[model samples]
Target: MKKLAFLVLLIVTVLSGTLVGKAIASTGFDAYSMTTHKIENGNLTNKVTDLISFTSQNIENEKNNDSKLVSINNVSDNVIDSSLSTDEEILQELSRYKDLENTYLMQPGWTSITFDQYDLLPLNSPKPLPSQYRKEFWSHFDGNQKVTEQVDYLISSETGKVPLGVFVNGELTSLWNDGQKVKKDPYTPAYDLYLVSSIQTLVESNSPLELSFKQEILANQSVSLIELRTQFSTTDKQWINIQLDKPVWGQYEKFTFNSQTGLLLKYEHYYVLDDMSLVLSSVTDNFEYSVASEAPSDVTNLIATGGK
Candidate 1:
């Protein structure tokens, strides 16, 4: 019983951190769309891979890479082209985040991020929470995650299927189920962004794995798909040492890209951590992006009502 309580506590803490950040300003471009998924893991694994060194000389030699090009003849719309690798695409996206002035999230069916937290410590060891119970427990969450540059918003899927917490310029007011603003948390921060403009340097950006495995398939009526099991890590100059053993927690990502346009249709980001005591945890993010001609009604309505 005590172990279960502890597991709950850890999950609550990390889960809260997974949600929220400043969002891109509204561009009124209904065609832009996105879906963000975050998976939190806290499980240990006995399996290990002695990844290659991140030094310049040890990286993959792409000189004659054209001869080693991976081709899939039976392809469609989901395939990734040979010109750019998956690692390059990911770096491009993260860099795009850096250039964006304002980003937005939590738009119901349109632009929203779904955060799922999981605890995979062994139950007998007073660490691992059973996977079966995680679904239901995590299903009930109150979050204020957005694409903006801050983490002070609130939304609950369990509540009327809308973002109940609304912030206007710098003021937060609670919106009830009837879509009316009411008094809630009356605080907001000044015009300070959390991540985008603060960091001066990208200390290190490295891909830990190269060509561990690859698969080819046809998806979406003809896009060629090249599935790559890749890994990456990045450090920023603004990061301060918090007495953690390894400041760099790498991601084991599975990417599925459309070979034609060099676009990423879907991908999963996984990371693991271990507590001082024998408890190990893992986190994952499943991300999806699309180009639409219009925004969903739910999101449009939310904006129409001043984020009500």
Candidate 2:
């Protein structure tokens, strides 16, 4: 057995009104313990971390020395059973969408992405924030030679609903609430901002997200789901589903990708409760797609203001 050099753990943090991904790892195993705090309005809310142990054979719970133990014995060489697709296969599928600028320009389509956030706490807990928060984005791409792209964002929060702004060609080109009229600042939003972008960013990231994810998967027990399923309303389209159980911060995540284009279709995160019940925390769904047309008023007006 070869002792692989320890690589950094990839923690994908979601800051959509909540924070997650708090995992500490040694060589081949990840042991997550400690308090996860949520800061809201200058106040802190604490939640006890659940102990989940992943082994080469299976995942179990071990309570010792007032700490939870998640052990992975000789996991560096462990191969997931033949029934499940290997991490390499998943990465190969993901690599297909790496060239976003080219893919969008060649095929040119628009997608409506809706992100829904639900109550993370238990049902009986007093809610300090809105029970549900909805954020939306519209990404348009013209198949022109210039590869024009524009994204519009709207967010609903405790203060109320408002249009976040617009990003044209990866630049914040427009603003309404801020009264900026025209601003062309480089925009580097979260990977999960859009469905296709989520996949593209993961593949294009300079960080070892793919390697760390593969190491984490191969360094553990069985995964929840890794298979292809037919998408609803589209019999010809197939989607690949990958679900990670208790990967980090006791969060369960499911990722759906277009089997053909490798573009992400959905990403879902669930919070585990004391009673072991799961609460959906956030989800981004790419439900609709259509051919792109002329630029929206936001993008056009921003360019008209000399944001050339």
Task: Estimate candidate 2's alpha-carbon lDDT, on a 0 to 1 scale.
Answer: 0.32
- lDDT by residue (140-257, candidate 1, tens digit) is 0113322221111222344323333333333323332233332223222111121212111121323234422233454332222222222222321112111223332322333343
Q: Stretches of candidate 1 above 4 Å error?
A: 1-160, 164-215, 220-250, 261-263, 272-301
Tens-place lDDT digits, model 2, residues 202-254: 34543222221321232133322222211111211111011223221222345
Q: All candidates' lDDT scores?
A: 0.26, 0.32
Q: List the residue pairs that clash in candidate 2.
A: 53-70
The candidate 2 region of ten consecutive residues with least summed lDDT is: 26-35
Clashes of 2: 1
Best model per lDDT? 2
Q: Which lDDT value does model 1 have at 274?
A: 32
